[model samples]
Target: MDASPLRDPTIGTGAAAGGPAPGRVVIDARALSLTFDTADGVVHALSDVDLTVREGEFVSFIGPSGCGKTTLLRVIADLERATGGSITVDGVAPAEARTQRLYGYVFQAPALLPWRNVLANVTLPLEIFGMDKASRLEHARRNLDLVNLAGFEKKFPWQLSGGMQQRASIARALSFDPKLLLMDEPFGALDEIVRDKLNEQLLKLWAETAKTVVFVTHSIPEAVFLSTKIVVMSPRPGRIIDVIDCDLPADRTLEIRETAQFLAIAHRVREGLRAGHSYDD
Candidate 1:
């Protein structure tokens, strides 16, 4: 949970995007492209992408193996520099906001500290920022409750199940209460059962907090269920192919995955994924 509590609440109250400002945008990207000059060749990880994420929308990125899903995420997080174009988070440069701890990023793995207890793990970011013990402790308790892990705070990472550990990681991320959350395949290693359970909790958290999330995944059904919008990308000089708005009825439950509209959205995402996979460049 490399996050600072001063940024956002453990859960926010935002109900829509374009809400933080009167007429301004929360996130904006214009003709964004990122190319890496590796010895093998110039890797065009992203190209000519124009995207906007409102203050509290949930967006997902899905595509094939080399489609630049994670790369695009990194660029927005300011972890990577785009070769061209511009990206701004919360109307500020990503680099500055990131340095200021504007949001917390959850990568593919939990990456928790084994030696630390669950509470300590969640408080790691605050510790780095020089927050005192009493303050971090109180903040950690609130986040643990947000993720439904309040009783397990004293347990070490090794003491928890995979699902629980991931939950702890999420609590760690949210303990700082960032308005924007960037996740790169955070559930990629879990079983379907565990993944589904986490999905329910994630939606609940999103509803409670109204935080903006940008998730990267290769799973069509997962993307369809969790996102208000899905951005499809293609590989080989990876570029955005389409940006589809998910018009599914809100208040989605696990059962919603089986509904007609959900499946239809899944079908559309699959078609897009297939198209991205077939492209050589």
Candidate 2:
């Protein structure tokens, strides 16, 4: 897969090594916490969480199941409110950011409308936003092509493969051109082969768009492969355990996974998870 878009001369993580300078902060969260009051009792999903995501960076959140990875992503998207602390998306409140359409969210499932063809599905957000038919169609076509789904426009969601449906979902997310893309395990259901292909496409897409991305995944390899930074969290009552920087080549391929640097980063991620996990739980 041509990774030319992400190619850079630098070989390591820091800007001192002549790497690209850091972009302005796109997401800033300090002492962020979320709790739920259910019929049974109080459930703390997150606590004392702090994180920052900058423009054009691929940040992944990884931990065990029920570790509040999705919850944290949702909080950033304004789908769930933080009970305490502060978070700013693009220097504004998440709710305000959502109102301004500062980010596009992709849930675990493709969540495409089964009845609508791919073109219509991709254009649905634009249609809801009161865009003209011609303009929405143009945006839909451009995004579908961006995701390599150009000719599948006439196919309904049911007619497409699972991977294709997810690609359509990604197209729908990109159609509106949001500044940040928030994905929650969008490829978790796919087999290994399909997942790797989508990961490659996602990296190329990220390189081409330069949009900030915050992804949630349980797979350590997936997190390490695609992220410039990996945030490891504790099992429920999720707290940031470790934040590992990835210094791999910008033009990295799946084969990079076998390299010493990649394995070292993956090892650190594994150690962080082990440190935070409790077998009893």
lDDT against the true structure, each candidate: 0.82, 0.89
Highest-lDDT candidate: 2
lDDT of 1: 0.82
Which residue runs does candidate 2 get wrong by more than 4 Å? 1-19
Report the error of model 2 at residue 271, Å: 0.5
Error of 1 at 264 (Å): 1.3
Off by over 4 Å in 1: 1-24, 279-281
Q: List the residue pairs that clash in candidate 1.
A: 1-172, 8-177, 12-209, 17-55, 18-55
Error of 2 at 132 (Å): 1.2
Model 2 C-alpha lDDT per residue in residues 60-146, reported as the tens digit of each score: 999998788999999999999999999999899999999999899998999999889999999999998999999999999999999
RMSD (Cα, Å) of model 2: 4.3
